[model samples]
Target: MDNYRPVSFWFDSLDDPVLDLREPPAQVDVAIIGAGFTGLWTAYYLKKKQPRLQIAVFEAETVGFGASGRNGGWCMGTATGIEHMLSVPSLQAEGIRLQQALENTVDEIERVCQAESIDCHFARGGTLNVAGTPEVAKRSQQWVEHLHRLGFKDSEYCWLDQAQSEKRIGLSRNLGAYYTTHCAAIHPGRLVRGLAEVNRALGVQIIEKAPVFNYTRVPDGSLLLSTGRGAVRAEKIIRATEGYTESIQGQQRSMLPLYSMVVATEPLSPEIWQEIGLTRRETFGDGRRVVIYGQRTVDDRLVFGGRAGYYFGSKRRALIPATDKAVKIVEASARELIPALRDPALGETVFSHGWGGLMGVPRHWRPCVTFDERSRIGWAGGYTGEGVGASNLAGRIMCDLVAGEKSDLTTLAWVDDVPRRWEPEPIRWLGVKSIEFFGDRADRREANNQSAGIWGSLFNRFVG
Candidate 1:
């Protein structure tokens, strides 16, 4: 396990195309802090809407350096949750509107991928929320009932029996599943790289390897972002630095950067594909309290990931560089979910890559997009681990907000939803550590066909 390489298989397999970089413009109409999906998509749509705007994207590493490139790659319309919708009555209407918008965003992603001729292996296979244990299967049924209570039709979300789940996922021990057609799988690294090029083609300047320290409000009412080389002034500044938000001064308590790890097996043979029949390559996860996600890559490899690393004090130690233990846990969970991988004869199932990255979790457990016109500062993030499709939505809404257009996007639930700061020090540390510990125990209990009890309920209320 110590010999495990920490590089992403996607990065290793593909030659990174050079990005068009120029010295950060002395001044620009807009300056974006991070060049991940949110920044790129915001630039892309902003330029598309108003071609004459001067936009510059600053990246500490490169495009998709964070979760954008290193995700399970499910373009799903699940950003808004029922609980978030019901958080308050005033938010209900906006949440419902946001939910519909997110569903449309899934289609918009396909539209953009086709229009740009981006060969990122975009597949329209749905998502299967499977249950590997009886307890989880019961919860899956409850989920279906909950959806029904919310006026959803069976066509939107349907419960599948054990045999049907096995037929779809080829996992022998699956107790049941909840299937939805509103999700797709894509090559994350390829998609984000292509997006950078598309934005560049549209006259967006991308400056890579330029780490942003902080921003200052200039006397002229513009924002100046301080970087290694020099300061770049802009009429508007966008903090698109999702998990890296803490790197900027005064924002450490804004969002929790949690590390999630992944492992990918080498390309399996045709016989192995037949045995592990993900014919449509649907993205999948189970009903455990500890989240795990997986997808069948375009090259016929299983790319699986899970959240097994949790560091307190908002340290985000998991993927600053992934620990060997975290990667091992993810690999083991993948094997546990799909027993076919444990077949001794399939020595070809050796893992070829292991990697980890950070996802931003808000203090209030809700995703948000906010812009303060007075400060000329805006940000869109905190999707937990569900930012792929949501980022596109965020980009569009941010464009509307920055342009001072009072459109429907501005009326969404997440707009200006600034959550409270995380508590100070040892209190914060103890709370987070306890939550993670209970989550692990809940997963084990569910795996043993037992209930998660109060701890699981607490987890759902806190971080679900």
Candidate 2:
């Protein structure tokens, strides 16, 4: 219950030698910044393609310390909605291409673990996207129809009627649901640590706590990445920083660092688990304007997360505890859906962990990847709360770009610039809070209406 101590869950389980690079070398074939999924996967693919290439990764903190380690642990194959992508053609094409590329990321991740013989409790039981209201149910119906039209027959998403949804998810308030077979739940921290171990075994160099201060383009057409302790020069550089891209040269202040928070309950009794009827080990999220997501842990505990509130402040900020009102709302929602958990004798399950981290979001809510051919600098981010599988695909694309390959991965378009710039620091924080407040209100109003109609449109425009 102590903030979901993943270190205890993961560290004792690893069997590989830890590589702690104290200082950067003089030169390398590739230098990657950030050690999350994107950075680690980039190194993984690069090593597979060119085993002799000198690859080095620089991390500001320990590997997986960012969102990669702290995320909700859902590995979904699809990106955002196809309709949302179709509304923007450039992003639409990119979305299609990325979806195709990511079709195997979940499998690939599982394969990597199996090949390495790492046990992270990876399960491909699927995910349930439940509707919290009739309006949301309508949207889910439209989405199912849309996916069928897009030739996604193999997606394995079934339309669960209201009764079926409530019976399956133990949530009576849900109107309907869409079940997708393409998602998997992973121990995020273990996955990251395992990847780091595999990378080191493959001869990839990883340096932790090495914050990159600056980089210079040498006259020889190479990059010299300067860190606080040392420097490393490489022929090509890849920026894999997700929410923390603001620290890199030419990338600073280019991304909006939005915060997301999660809370995990204490392990439940076997009786409670049986009563909940969630034995399939699937993840769940309601289709509300302010969506809430929950998943059953391998250890019989339930983890839930949602928008903490409107945040208008620093990108690297943490979330405060839930207000009494918010806690009551969440607890009541849980009880309403799970009768087994309603008994007072079960005792109150205190939240063991409550933490928040930043994620990058562009104006259009599409993942962006940029390549500078002349400078040999490439970057990718802006997953918009759906980065798990998307980041893996981005990692592969980034490696392809660095290797100068003209593969299908490079066909995706990249946003030339970041979204809107906010006011400096303190003012930006206030603005975030105001936006969050407004967004929450709009979500509630739209959810109460049978048809979002004008109010829904307004909410979409504001968030967009």
Clash list (residue pairs), candidate 1: none
lDDT of each: 0.82, 0.71
- How many residue pairs clash in all the candidates, one count each? 0, 10
Q: Which ranges of candidate 2 are over 4 A from the true structure?
A: 1-21, 81-83, 86-94, 308-315, 318-342, 345-347, 413-435, 446-454, 462-464
lDDT of 1: 0.82
State the lDDT of candidate 1 residue by residue for 362-406, as single tens digits. 888777888888887899999888899999999999999988899
Off by over 4 Å in 1: 1-7, 17-21, 80-93, 316-323
lDDT (Cα) of model 2: 0.71
- Look at candidate 2 and tell me the lDDT of residue 460: 68
